[model samples]
Target chain A: MARRSEHTREQLRDLMLEAAEQLIVDKGLAGLSARAIARQIGYTPGTIYLVFANLDELILHVNARTLDRLRVPMQAAVAATDDPEQQLLGAARAYADFARSHPNLWRACFEHRLPEDVAGPDFIDARIAQLVELIMAPLARVSGAEGAALDAAAQSLWSGVHGVCILTLTGKLHMVGGQATEHLTDDLVTHYLAGLVMRAAPADAR
Target chain B: MARRSEHTREQLRDLMLEAAEQLIVDKGLAGLSARAIARQIGYTPGTIYLVFANLDELILHVNARTLDRLRVPMQAAVAATDDPEQQLLGAARAYADFARSHPNLWRACFEHRLPEDVAGPDFIDARIAQLVELIMAPLARVSGAEGAALDAAAQSLWSGVHGVCILTLTGKLHMVGGQATEHLTDDLVTHYLAGLVMRAAPADAR
Candidate 1:
């Protein structure tokens, strides 16, 4: 009987997250509320509190789910490519593709801010680290930059790709001639990686 | 008497924009509305519509003012430095600074979406072009990448900087030991510029 009850609770949590994600997809972040989630799930608001601490907690859980969805394509992209440059490029393209396909969920990952007094959960940090590690491998291979340098390079490069994605997603890039997101992503990764490789090259080769 | 009324009409327009900007600063974009702007400026909602076509137009004008504010610092940054690399770096720093200082207004520049049916005004396009042109001279000096290449480079680099600013501004970067925005900005500009210069360098020197 206890096992069945535990199983039900887990199922309820999943249902709430799904309902919340769907709400965001349909009406954006503003549309999400405990009352709304309960209505979507056909449950009382008290049932939500029993499963999750609050709306902020629910948001984090949803963002974690988004990160998980993001990880699959990114890992697949990395696995599909053997060359370091292609691996990095593929991962970036995958990231942008994920953002485009799941605009609201992907955005919520970045857009949602926890309150000042509240600290982000450790699991979310682990998720972000996992995403960063995906790029670190190819970056380390290309630049031979290790320790802090490698970290900075990975963050900087990823930020650039992310910037391209944000601008492209938001239509900000349209004003500049509507360059395709893939082209911009490729341009950023290609040029940035080329620069890294050349910087690491020997002076005689230069 | 006609000229005096025209002057008052222009003054009212300026007053309305100022009020709207202040409201956004105080309460964010969500708090902004035609009625709110009218209230802020001691006028009726109908008065705001009379001066600007609608709330969206007022937002656009406010964004234009933000862009104009951004341009001043960027151009000043360019003028402050003589070295091509320094000029580019300075301009990037300036851009980031502008975003940081006017978080609401800077965010509004990207966050405000015009209705799909309405075409963005030509003046907004011109404002964006002006910002892009700030980087062209230094980029040309560094890479000799002209015309299409230069334009691509400028857009790519700025996008990278913009990404860093967004991440830092939004607290997303804090998850990674809280790296300073300036550090990320410098790292991106340095590495990207270095790569551009190296690519342009003669093979023997490379």
Candidate 2:
């Protein structure tokens, strides 16, 4: 079926991303190629050029798409929660689950190196700030953690979750055994969260 | 310079890892090859076969050596700290520093998918657990943080630091101008530590 001119751009963009995603799934990021994407998406190589200036632009678009998809569930996970700790956990779980299910796209989101000529948009950072916003205010409200301590806690929590996501995504967690991974992650999160709360509780110090 | 068999094996292993490291530095991991390593190390292709079964083993040996090197600095970082939060931060900083300096090996450590025939040794878990011991016990003692909360906090901190490390290593943070990468990392670490403490604090009688 021929794509009409009005929606051809949108259709082609989606097609290109879908094609690239498939290629990555099968061959990893290095396997992606404009010619292969063109062939797979049923577009002539010239048509891809019409839609994307080059492969970098196409990759940037797909990378943005991956971040957008990740942000949605992360926001939803936090927004649906009222307890600060619970909210953090919800977001963490959502992040881990999404990363696991969409390993290729997720990998592209984090691991893809931007070429010298290209710059990604600021939308991804804004999305992260939104997720961070969900947790930060509640943290600042705590009496004892009004400053630097609060900041450290947030950074710590964020890194710990990212480690799990990365380890699971790259299949590194498998080396430790699945059950051990689960247990260790659980222990780590529990301990870190306690540290966070303790730092903010002056009268009830650790 | 012909040498004893013992010296030959030691020199070969060192040569292999040094060559692989240079290759990664030159062309990145995707361009890595056993043949390239053999050539760079001044060994015939067949000579590489004696030190390792194949390219994958060679890469793994290099990665393990890198990790072992990292463990020393990381342990020292934690050893220099007595406070719980400081201990955690010191370890995280050490980890981040290693990632920044050895982006290729750092990347290899997390990208741990195993081919069917490649079985890993089992001691890495115990080594990691040693690191965990440094961060876990002190962190878990915080107020308002019980079992699960503590665990989540630890996990989140690990992930957040790893995220920053990877982003910095891969130049994902290059777009953020004005501040040096070290400054940005410092800011990230500081805020994370604060946030963790804030989150863990229990609200009670003022």
**Sliding window of 10 residues with minimal summed lDDT for model 1 chain A:** A1-10
User: What are the per-residue Cα lDDT tens digits for candidate 1 across A1-206?
Assistant: 12223437889899899999999987777679999988877787888899998899999999999999999999999999799888999999899889888877888888777765777789887888899899999999988888877877887888888888888777766533334677777777777877777677787764
DockQ of each: 0.53, 0.27
Please give, for residues A1-206, the per-residue lDDT of candidate 2 as tens digits: 24434456878788888898788867667779888997886667777888888887777777777777887887786788677666666766776777677777777767777654655657655655555555566555432465555554454455456666776555444333344344544544444555455544666453
Candidate 1 has a TM-score of 0.89
Residue-level lDDT tens digits of model 2 in B1-206: 24324347868888888889777756667768877876676667787788888777777776777778777887787679677666666777788778777777777766644563555645554454455555566566533455655555554455556766765565444333323334444544444555455655555532
TM-score of 2: 0.74
Q: Candidate 1: lDDT over CA atoms?
A: 0.82
Question: In model 1, which residue pairs have backbone atoms overlapping below 3 Å?
Answer: A205-B206, A206-B204, A206-B205, A206-B206
True contacts kept of each: 0.50, 0.30
> Which candidate wins on TM-score?
1
* Model 2: per-residue Cα lDDT at residue A189: 49
Which segments of candidate 2 are over 4 A away from where they belong? A1-7, A44-47, A116-119, A134-156, A171-194, A201-206, B1-10, B42-47, B79-88, B116-119, B123-160, B171-206
Chain B TM-score of model 2, please?
A: 0.74
Off by over 4 Å in 1: A1-8, A44-47, A175-179, A201-205, B1-8, B175-179, B201-205
Candidate 1 interface RMSD value? 1.6
